[model samples]
Target: MKIFNLFIFLFFVTTLSNAQEAKQDFYKRSFIAYEGCEDSKDLERCYEISFHEFLAKHINRKALKDSIFFEAKKDTITVSASILYDENGKVVKRHSRISNPASNRIEGLEYLLDSIPTVKPVLDKKNNGVALSTRKLFGFYLNKAKDTIVPIFGYTPSEVPYEIIEKVPVYKGCDESMSNEDLKNCMNDKVVQLISENFRTNLAIKHNLKPGIQRIYVMFKIDKKGRVKDIVARGPHPEIEKEAIRVIKKIPRLKKPGYQRGKPVIVPFSIPIVFAVSD
Candidate 1:
């Protein structure tokens, strides 16, 4: 298996506001008045960054350690949520659906939401605080090795690129004591080898794909714990894509997670796999 350039888009519904005037001009749209973002030149981006930072800091990670959401070797948890603010800029209502129904009633989440501070609501052209309703996508990565739950906020949260991260994730069997460059090379080689060994090439013939090179774009995140999560793939055929995901998911947990500036960070990766089909 040969690996090539990769790109990842953390697709999620970040902003779903009911402000009617926003349709007129996107750049002029009013953003929620998160503290310290009121004077930002780019208000929307600032709000997103500030909001994600708040969640990551205040979400009470330790309380989630024993939650059912992280059970059964689960590496990622996602939530589809709506937060409503009254004209007074208070969080009056909040609704969320977790990825796992078994953990539907999350106490940690309830406490976190309750702790959210009342920010200045987004104002309309009239300069009046407008009642607001917005939907958000939230996620959490389980670092099993450290027994920690890292909160992931907003759509497309900042993820360190592979080439730039201080230390790339090491595969389970790779020698971790090696230099960073060697470790990265070893990890990439291990990934290619794992995919080639596990991927079901016969699926291509079954799907009757054309007798040529078929490219499957695989995207995933290697979390702080070095576990594979959020695997997504696009290919010529649905079955082919499914097989690609299966092969990637089968990868064993890595020995070490990537680090940046002395702290572990989530790393996003995408790989182009060339699958050949035969008549």
Candidate 2:
């Protein structure tokens, strides 16, 4: 069935090249932390990078208690996930959910213990910035699935279609549901669409891509100013990788920038985008 080339390679460039870029050269390194095309979390990381602001735009919890909560609890912190591939590791579909336990930590910090009546607090935020629950929960993993070589285009690799598998979950995190102000502020520009298009066109032109299927993973940042700042990739591919990076570099700033208690800050990105042959 031709496998419908939904090409989304992660990132793979030397550290030396990245260190040489300018602060303004943010888009150039859009997907670095997410190299090696490890798993679905990598893709989710790319989404986090490319659309952090957009996603953050989605997170609005009226009360911390009512923040996005998971349906089930796990001994460790990892969303249930699955990778669809052949017997080898040639990836077909990489699927996963978002996860982070940092937000889940509430009971262990010593400073907050005094707030409770029954017990004398033994912990200290300075000494124990984390809760005991936080101690056991690890919300992320660094490419647990490691491999040196990968199947390049028309070649076969050792892990071709290996069905790389894991049992993470569809856990939900804090909600960033949009507000009237958020909708109004963002609608004037429809920033995500513009960014997506800019990258798409850049890929088609600069990369000399045709009407065939291509996969790409895009990464970028939404600084506190709401501007999409730094971007990089984490894995590799053929010409598609080059074009994907080029496209992300062209997106204009969305909102001026976001703020945390009224200050501009730099957020990082590690998102992935996919390109498929158009009909």
Candidate 3:
């Protein structure tokens, strides 16, 4: 009789666990992810989410998901995650992943694959955590691994090299109910941090040092959504400019791109990033 009762209790627990409903809050995240990621199957879209996506799709992200990336009070291509509210519709987790290359941080380099999908967090634990249902895991990995659209690579006519001073998400600040730190920590703000870091790192690498500071012109289309497109480098010597363009392409994606109206469109932007070694 005792064994029979235990079986019944176990059965009830299983039923209850499975009965939990999948919340709609997860739906809201797709907008944020899509906006912040800016429709890239192969690029850095936002800061924290970019980092997470980098991990979910990145062959090696599995190793460091638990530990936050911190060195010298800064982040180097890592995500800091803490599980918070776990109700059906909420996941109040605190996360930070900063990878500034200018400060000599070895992050965002040696990345061969351009786009990687982050595990789409599902309110259903079955699709998110350990032992995620096979269906969810397979679906998530398949979506990230496969490219939705063929990449359209664009370029400019100028013959000079340049660099992006900074890139960030454009959006209203987080809700007032959020703590000051959390508000600032919103995923959009991290965009600037990522841009600055990538900019500095490329400079440190002497990307354009050989014939530094030549008249170079770069033209790239920023889609209506503000994501970068049609990157081209043109200046005095086309060869070196191409090299610069190559590096520029290495930078991550912009989460919130500039917009003209309701639809996503491409806008043009230019910059001359000078490379000089200080004495």
Model number with the top TM-score:
1
Give the least accurate 10-residue stretch of model 3, judged by summed lDDT. Answer: 4-13
Mind giving the per-residue lDDT tens digits that candidate 2 earns over 71-99? 22322222111212122222222221222
Question: In model 3, which regions exceed 4 Å deviation?
Answer: 1-213, 276-279
The lDDT for every candidate, in the order shown, is 0.63, 0.30, 0.32
Best by lDDT, which number?
1
Per-candidate TM-scores read 0.44, 0.30, 0.26
Q: Single out the weakest 10-residue window by summed lDDT for candidate 1.
A: 3-12
Model 2 residue runs over 4 Å out of place are 1-192, 199-214, 224-227, 234-238
Is 1 or 2 the stronger prediction by lDDT? 1
Candidate 3 lDDT over 1-279, as tens digits, reads 011000000000001111112343433232123225545543223423344444345534422331222222322231212122223323332211122222323244223123322443323323443211110000012122332212111211111111111121232443534432343245324433333344333332343344333445665654545355688877555565675566557545544543221333343445554443332
CA shift of 217, model 1, Å? 0.5
Estimate candidate 1's alpha-carbon lDDT, on a 0 to 1 scale: 0.63
Tens-digit lDDT string for candidate 1 (56-136): 576554555656555645576544345666777787744322222234455556556666678777776667777766544
